[model samples]
Target: MKINYPDGRIFNSQPSKSSLHTTNAKKKLIFGDRGMTLEEEINESNKYYRAHDIAVIYKKPTPIQIVKVDYPKRSKAVIREAYFRQASTTDYNGVYNGYYVDFEAKETKNKNTFPLKNFHQHQIDHLKMCQKQGGICFVIIKYVELKRYFVMPADEIFIHWDAQFDGAKSIQLKDIEKGSIEIKADYNPTLPYINAVQQLIESGKEKK
Candidate 1:
């Protein structure tokens, strides 16, 4: 199978089983292959949101350039080599309550702080640009070790991001708690982040 990207790049969809095994092995060794990482949870939550007519958010697939392919049989083909063509804007984006919604989902094993290195300069700029265009932009951060999550506004994240040059490399857990909205994990939608988004929208109205 071949998948096409919006930029007109095409990639082979089939990956070798050996590659999958190796990737899963690495994940198991590092994160115990829990099969429920932050990305997966958010993806499931998006599916729920779409199903219930709540929102229409989706994870953006990374575009890749396929350089080499192997055809072992007449009916089978596999991708042998591939590389990223460029950096991605963010993890998720879509429409919610007539607002353009954009955000990135990130998780940290550190319990006390989230390292600023987890974010990229391009992502920060993208959020800033989106906010300027009247879009709701934020980041969903998960403290993996502590089993906690927060929906942090992009403005708050920018504050900490700018502080990096002043010798601040990470945001303290306490600061995150003070500046962000905590979200309770649930079974139905997994992360249920849309509720926090609703609160953010209402809070913005109150300020206005």
Candidate 2:
């Protein structure tokens, strides 16, 4: 099957990795070609959770606007031209243990710090709204080169996001260690991030 766009372009099936991320990803030592992306890992785990009755989390699908389509067969159709509808606010959101769980997953190649540039202001604002509504909000960060995973609460993220304006471009590894819950990736559901979510819920109770 072949799709030729009216604009002399081929089918825009999926977004290329380079086009999806910032230009910094190309220059940085991301070491990402070796394994699954953070989004894929979380999605796989979400599937497992659904099957096992653990949680009902899912990756919110990005809405795509199809400008052109080609139907070579009666049942097969190819998108010749398409574009994303809007910037998605967060990655995964759902219910866990009677609580609303919302989070964004991010992976970085930096060894010293997780660059705040990886996040957007709208994502932060979405977390804020969820938190105010008593939702358990956080971010799952994966260090590509280090093979480390951490679930940092939305509050900690807000602190660093605001500080970026005052010269803090990233969150130090030590600070992340102190403020977040570490998750050891495993075999069953892959990354058992829901365990960290449990810890966050407990901590919220403690604070209250």
Candidate 3:
């Protein structure tokens, strides 16, 4: 099974640092803004979907490899160092209306181009595998500096990735304009993504 890394990188499951809610809190304090991290926005949106029974999506837990352990107390063990193992799949996965949903959330500051380096080869492979299984796979990309968001389909990403070495490496904003679903900012869910997913499903149905 695919596992997530503590730093939001997905990897294989291995014993590692005991989860500290305090660490998550610290991360929030440092990164939190009206415009939170793209991951955080997706998380909150998932929570909203759960509460409303719209979909059952979640951010997968991270996998950690604990190297050193200290039994400082009878009740707790402290982990000192760890290295993450390789992940076998994507970051988020779940069922939405009987369809498999798998995707990643990312952010970029550039207004004209979305860099290909933001995505990893392993992640692209994972998404391709998921798509072959008739799953809906996409990325929720946030142009943070422009305050714009787009749900770019995995296939579109793959096309560029496949030709990246040939010099068509970057996903231009104009390209995104043609294929991606532009998401409007919302009050409660912040980055409303379910709407984008719904649009994707609808568009797929139209094609069929």
Number of the top lDDT candidate: 2
List ranges where model 1 is wrong by over 4 Å: 1-35, 69-78
Pairs clashing in candidate 3?
A: 4-62, 4-63, 12-86, 16-66
- What is the per-residue lDDT of model 2 for residues 1-208, given as tens digits with 9 covering 90 to 100? 2311123111222333443764543332133223666765676577678878999998776768899999997678999999866555796899998999999999998897889989998899999999999999999999988999999999999999999879999999999999999998765576899999999999899999
The residue ranges of model 2 lying beyond 4 angstroms of the native Cα positions read 1-34, 70-73
Sort order, lDDT high to low = 2, 1, 3
Candidate 3 lDDT over 83-137, as tens digits, reads 6766666678888888899998778888898989988988999999998998999
How high is each candidate's TM-score?
0.80, 0.81, 0.81
Off by over 4 Å in 3: 1-33
- CA lDDT, every model vs. true structure: 0.80, 0.80, 0.75
Question: Residue 119: error of model 2 in Å?
Answer: 0.1
Candidate 1 local lDDT, 1-208, one digit each (tens): 2211112111222232233545553343233225456775676577668878999998776667999999997678999999866555876899998988999998898989899999999999999999899888999999888889999999999999999999999999999999999997776577889988988888888988
Task: Using lDDT as the measure, name the better of candidate 1 and candidate 2.
Answer: 2
